[model samples]
Target chain A: MLKYNFSAGPCVLPQEVFKKAADAVLDFNDLSILEISHRSKDFVQVMEQAQSLAFEHLGLQDKGYKALFLGGGASMQFLMCAYNLLENKAAYLNTGTWSAKAIKEAKMFGEVIEVASSKDSNYNHIPKSYSVPSDVDYFHFQTNNTIFGTQLQETPSVEVPIVCDMSSDIFSRQRDFDKYDLIYAGAQKNMGPAGATLVVVKEEILGKVSRSIPSMLDYKVHISKDSMFNTPPVFPIYVSMLTMQWLKDNGGISWIEELNNKKAGLIYNEIDRNPLFEGFVTDKADRSKMNATFVLKDEAHKDAFDQLWKDAGINGLNGHRSVGGYRASMYNALSVEAVETLVSVMQELERKG
Target chain B: MLKYNFSAGPCVLPQEVFKKAADAVLDFNDLSILEISHRSKDFVQVMEQAQSLAFEHLGLQDKGYKALFLGGGASMQFLMCAYNLLENKAAYLNTGTWSAKAIKEAKMFGEVIEVASSKDSNYNHIPKSYSVPSDVDYFHFQTNNTIFGTQLQETPSVEVPIVCDMSSDIFSRQRDFDKYDLIYAGAQKNMGPAGATLVVVKEEILGKVSRSIPSMLDYKVHISKDSMFNTPPVFPIYVSMLTMQWLKDNGGISWIEELNNKKAGLIYNEIDRNPLFEGFVTDKADRSKMNATFVLKDEAHKDAFDQLWKDAGINGLNGHRSVGGYRASMYNALSVEAVETLVSVMQELERKG
Candidate 1:
């Protein structure tokens, strides 16, 4: 059975990348990627090349950024960024679940000022305005809210260093790289796999925390080792590099963004036109180009609609358990053809009704 | 080519597991594994089954211990264990690089006492005697030294809680589970992949530390969430579960130990009897059954001998750069057939000389 995947993360990846990764899993150039020592020249080259490609993709050459592939997910970075950069206090604008997780981790490290929150409205929209503390070490935000299907259309311009968790939306759009002092994303979403977390940091903001940090958790130690301080998640990073290469070969982020816009537009149009369904978020401007969320207008039809989608060979369209509805995650790798098929299914259901 | 992998960690897995993982990567039960949510009942079942199987394989039923698959590897546990358990001081047995890493992590949390050292012999032998401080929280040691090619024949019987980094030799032997209060291992060597770390800790020993530990780094937090406090390395854990299932089906760790001993004996015998090579570690009792270290008798012939092995489709046999010699890491998944092939290669080299 050929199924189209629309899960928020650990989402779809290019079939070519999967084939390459599977081949390497058994035998990587006759030396399994796992078997090769991290310090070995062959594996070092793999690390260096992965970082180089990431920087190239992000266009971060003289931006004073260090690219590191570390374990733990983007959730860890919320604490890591706070532990490494937050000295006295930090400010966070909570948009969704990921931002909340980040803010919680930040509070453990230092005094965290919740500048603004969308939770009052059940996080149906991104916060409009927030104050950035001049004394605060950094300001943090999530670019896209996976659960609520909302995105901050513009990067928050703050006086302090701005850190972002772009886990679901990174590399899907083109933006000025200089806007963020640090950015991190788990590879499972738009990148590669779940094992590695890709972090790009401004080197100067580190080494200020008074707290004793574990060597593995410390971004500085990873930077010093070139992200090979310990044996890295070799297979994940290698596949990520290949994914980046694929992204590059396919005309980079701008191309992906254009394609993503088309996919999101196709699905959103169907939801808006269909009488039985209505978008959950209710705000058009805040609608995410990555994850499109909708609910049945007649609540009784929800389960039947879900089954209809499942019967149509669509998987992972069910919304997060917390946000009980349907969510179609249109990540960069999700093909336009898949979106077309989903839209057609919705239309056919409407015609039959 | 049928390449034999002898890398200490990120080592070989059963070919069956690899094929299964590969099949899932492309399409897992008709949906790619990456496409599924971790919160899904299917993935949750995977975690439950893996943990249940791991405990069963170790014969750890109703032992007042919890099995957790975590991130940051065993290195993270060094700090986590110390932060959670150490109040005043902890004792450490210095065996090799891994032990040194553990000692370094422990120092950040509290006073760490080095009870014994084999550094005098370049850590080629595990220390025979160590003073355990009854006042300390726990005693720490590495069971098998991967780089130095040595193993502790028997872990020291200590009154305080024992925490061992059994990263390399885990699942290679059967052991009395009662010996240690906590045991942690990175799943790269014998268990599975490079991303997940396996932790087995007594439940009663937690929540005793004064320091405020980060939620993600705290073992208690993981235990509370059933190791799902954060998004886990799901794919790696799944692969680990498959490997655990494989081990269980093959008669568990006791059966694995017999096969391990048989493989180690064959290669060690060949090294001892061959005039063309010599074992690097001096003591007979200290040799590791997992990683065997040897040097060519004639220094000039090292390159030629290495090339000979490489040409024979044997890979990752090079020793750590810190110790310039050859190391054939016969991890648990490595077959006796592979070790017999290695012994034949050594014999052939001797005959050529």
Candidate 2:
């Protein structure tokens, strides 16, 4: 079936990037990238180029910050960050599923102080008034709650280092990168494919924890090896490089932010204006620009609406199993045209009602 | 330029698999697999089918054995196995660099007892003496040493549970699958690609360790979730399934084993017969059937021979920098014609000498 993808993650990638990646799979510089040794100069060049592009495009000039592409995804980083930084009690603001997972991983390594939680409201809104402990090592939060369709407009002002899991909202908007002591994201969502995770860490903050961290799990090991501590997810890093290059070519983060905002605006406006559909997330200000969650007024209409979208070749529009509604994730690579098509469907549904 | 790949691994795969994989990069089932949601039925089906095919082809009827595809490659399994099995000291048979690494990871979790080591022989041979302590939790070994091109012709008889890192020789030949309690291989070598690792383990052996293992690093958690503990390396697993299916379709392990034997025999015969070249491993019985390591008789001819192979479109023929000269990895997917081509080149070098 001919389909337009709006999946939350392992999400859509630019056609151009896909074409280039496909070409490289067969013959990466006349040798299959798959067959190329990770230690070889050719692959080293690939690694360096990708890393350079990522740092360059992000406009990160801080020498203290090291950008690493490592294994085990962002969920792995929750523990890694905690293991590396959380020696004493660490504070976390639980907003949604990912934050809860991060908190769970943190508690495994050290004393985790959940400063605030929106769980009482079913995580429909970002928690306010984080009570950071004076002895806490760092405060952690997910910048965008992927499952709940909520986002922290600005990182919580805290006395300690600010760690953020920017898995869903990374590079979607402009922010002072230096404010975050650490930021990490799984590449499957907005970056590239599923294997690699991007970790940006402040170098000075490491080596504080008194725990014997595994070399593979240690961010310092990756920082020293430049993320070549072991054979990395080479193809994902390569595809991510191409995507970042595409982002730069199309006028960097500023351009992407504008495009993303326009796309999000179109869909949010439609959801607000339509009577048949209701936005699930209570707070409009806290609503994610990446994933927009909504539900039809009549629950019966959900199945029919889903079929309509599926028949129209819209894929991955179903919300997470936990959320139980519709979530159209308009990630960076998702076209504005796709959002427009979805808006048209919503309009058609409203007219029919 | 047409290139022949002989890298120890991230080695060559079937050209057909590469072509099909490349096609899938842009569109899988008319929808880009990259864009497919992990929760979607289509991808779930992919995961189920892959697992089913792997179990079917491995002829694994023992419900106690669970097959899992995970991230972090074989190196991760070193820690995972120790975390799952080790209560006190574990026994290790150090065969090569990889075995040493496994030993190191094991030590971090518990006291690792060196049962045997062949490092005195420059890891040119697999150690024959293996004294698995009755008190030790598990005995570990690398099935095939990629660097030195030596393989264990038979499993070492040990009372303790056996854990093998079969990264380079998993499906190259058929063996009695019931011998080992656990076996794992990084996919880049003999399987499909670099992003995933295949782990086959017995269920009864887990939960014996006393240490608080990280959930991501826990085998029990993964086994409980059927390896869907997190969003997996979906594409890599899918491609691996296709490769496994290909193996099954082409008359299963017996046929592939016969072909692998032929390919290795042709290359080994040429190495032994060619006056200009000498096999590096010294012991004839210790020679690997997968990676055939050799060097030019005259050091002056080394560069010339390398260039000759490169010009003849042979790639990844260079041995690891740690152990330099040449390594022609005859993986299962490598065509017999490629081996014949390599043999012919060896003959031409001998004639030149």
Q: Considering every candidate listed, which one attains the maximal lDDT?
A: 1
**Candidate 1 per-residue lDDT over residues B158-269, each given as its tens digit:** 8999998889988889777677889998989988888889999989899887878778878888999998887788788888999998998988898999999999899899
- Predicted complex 1: DockQ: 0.58
lDDT of candidate 2 at residue B185, scale 0 to 100: 87
Query: What is candidate 2's lDDT per residue for A74-191, written digit by digit as tens?
Result: 8788878888998878999899988888998899877988888999888999877657877789989999988889988875667789898998888788877778899898888878
Span of ten consecutive residues with least summed lDDT in model 2 chain B: B54-63
Best by DockQ: 2
Against the hidden reference, what TM-scores do the models get?
A: 0.96, 0.97
The regions of model 1 sitting more than 4 angstroms off are A31-34, A40-42
- Which ranges in model 2 have alpha carbons more than 4 Å from their true place? none
Q: Encode model 2's per-residue lDDT on B1-353: one tens digit a residue.
A: 45577877787888878888898888887777777777768788877887777667667765678888888878778878887888888899898998998888888878999978888878887777567888888888888999999988887777889898998988878777688889898888777788789898888898887778777888888888878888888777877877787888888878888998898889888888888888888778888889999887788777667667767778778877667778899887888888888888887777776
Q: What fraction of the true interface contacts does model 2 reproduce?
A: 0.56
